[model samples]
Structures are given as structure tokens and as C-alpha cells.
Target: MDETVTAVIDDVVARAAAHDADEPDRLRRWRVLEPDAGRLLWFLVQSSGARDVVEIGTSHGVSTLWLADAVRSTGGHLSSVDADPDVQDAALANLVRAGLDAHVTFGTGDGGAALAGLDEQSVDLLFLDAERTEYPGWWPHPVRVLRPGGVLVVDNAFSHADEVAPLAALIDEHPGLTSTTVAVGKGELLALRSR
Candidate 1:
């Protein structure tokens, strides 16, 4: 990432931290992927030369910005999903601030519904950072939409192991997927579908 993008990410993250501190009791305000995890997401998109990325969860656009940065380089576009209009607006503003808004399309309401609407084998990268328990029920779409060799990155694997275990076990049962749990920012459950 360039200095400009770096500065924007740092500023956004700091502002988000402040907001969380100020609004301690807010429910949805509790979930922003750690900076290291965000960077890893960025690197994966960049290195894979992934053009079609579908990201579930656009919390404050922190992760979306990182993904948008890579998509911009790859001449790709990102369709990011979030259920809250306010959060979507905040994410849109942040993307515009970073000059990455052109690389993204924002969807509001029912992320799972949005995800289910995708075409088969249409995605190059699928990033799951939404509800933990809801993941298992939402599994089939990613499995269908993600092309062979696509990367599936699930957030909060270790941090929310119990809640996300079913999805983890589901991945384990899929013979075509090779998986690993990496201890980087809330822990990521990374998997690659076989070709």
C-alpha cells in the first residue's frame, strides 16, 4: 500500500477506535477486524490477482478499504455487503475519502441474501466476516460461488471458536478444501478449494 492509503487506513482505524470508546454500549459498533488481519486481506487479494471479490461485512469500511485498494490495482471491483444503512454510509464516506469509492459497490440489508444471489463460480475471493453462527447456514453459497482455487477467509476463528465451529467442521468435511487456522488478528480460518 502507498503512503496515502496507509495514512487513510490509520486515520480511519483510529477514528473507529475513538467511536467505539465513545459508544461503549453500541452493539454493532463492536466488530472491526484488527489492522493486521485487514492487511492480510489486502495482501491476499493483491497477490492472487483476484478480480472478482465478494466481501461479507463492510463494518466502517475498514476492511472494504483494504480490499478496494487491491481491487483498484487489479482493475477489479468489489461488492461489499452490510445490513446497516448507517454503517454502509460511513463505509461509503471512508471509501470516498481514500479515493477508492470507484472500486466498490455497496449493498445494504441481509448479507446472506445478497450472498445467495451470486452466480456459480463467479467469485475469485470470498471473505467472511459476518455473524459466526450464521456462517454454517450461509456456507453453500460461497462453496458454489467461489471458483475452484478461490480463497475463503473466515474471520474470528479462534476468538469465536465455539460459535464458528460448525462452519470450521463443515470446511473440514469438504474433501476438496485444505484448511488452516492462523493466529493473526482474532485468528483467520483460511481455506482453498481444490481445482
Candidate 2:
């Protein structure tokens, strides 16, 4: 990322941190990804040439800004979904401020339902930072929409391991994907969809 872009991202993150802290109740379950994790998300997307990415959570668009940096380069787009209208609106405003609005599409609703609505094999990357335990039930949608060799990233495996253990186990046991957990921010479960 360029210096100008980096500055924009930093400013946005700082603002989001304050906003989240103030209204903890409203955005409690929908926490922002750690700065370390945000950097990694940007690296993964930038390195992988993933054009079409779907993020399960978009709290104030902190993570989305990172993804957008890479998507902007590839001329691709990112679609992010969250259940709260207020949260979604906040994210949209943040994106606009960051000058990343052109690379993203914000949606309001369940992540699973949003993923199910996408075309099959259309997504190059699927990122989950929402409910970790419910990951299993939503597998089919990502599995169907994620292109072969596409990557799926699940956050909170280390920070909230017990809660996300079922998801890790299933990913490890699944036949169509290969996964490994990296010690990035909070630990990220990175998997590649194999045909």
C-alpha cells in the first residue's frame, strides 16, 4: 500500500476503535479485526490475486479497507455482509472516507444467506470473522461459490479456539479442502478449496 493509502487506513481504524468502544453493546458481537490481522488479510489478498472476495463481517469496514487495497489493484471487487443496518451504514461511510468505496459492495443480512445468493465458483476468497461456531452450517454456500483453488479464511481460531474448534475440525476433515492455521492475529485458519 502507498503512504497516502496507509494514512487513510490508519485514520479510519483509529476512528473505528473509538466508535466500537463507545457503542460496545451495538458492535460487541461484530468486533473489528485486529490491526495485525488486518495487515495479513491485505497481504493474503494482494499476494493471491483474488479479485472477488466475500467478507462475512464488516464492522465499520476496517477489514474491508484492507481487502479493498488489494482488490483495487486487481480491478476486482469485494462484497461484505453484516446483519445490522447501523453497522452497515457506518462501514459504508468509512469506506467512502477511505476512498475505497469503488472497490466494495456493502450488504445487510446473514452471511450464510448472502453467500448462498452468490453464483457458484464466483468467489476467489471467502473471509469469515462473524460467528465461528455456526461455520459448519454455512459451509455449503461457500463450498459452492468458492472457485476451485480458492481460499477460505476463518478468524478467531486461536483467540477463541474452543468456540471455533468445531470449524477447525471440520476443515481438517473435509475432503475438498486443505487447511492450516497460521499464527497471525488471533490465528487464522487458511484453507484452499480443492477439486
After superposition on all CA atoms, what RMSD does each candidate show versus the true structure?
A: 1.3, 1.9
Clashes of 1: 0
- For residues 56-120, could you state the per-residue lDDT of candidate 2 as single tens digits? 98876778888988899888899999887787787787777778888988889888889879999
Task: Give lDDT tens digits, candidate 1, residues 1-195.
Answer: 777777888888888788788785646474687999998999989998999999998888888989999999999999999877898898888888889999999888776788789998899999988877788888777778888989899999888899879989998998878899999999999989885
Worst 10 residues of 1 by lDDT: 24-33
Please report the candidate that would top TM-score against the real structure.
1
Q: How high is the lDDT of residue 36 in model 1?
A: 95
Q: Quote model 1's TM-score.
A: 0.95
Q: What lDDT is obtained when candidate 1 is compared to the true structure?
A: 0.87
Which residue pairs come into collision in candidate 1? none
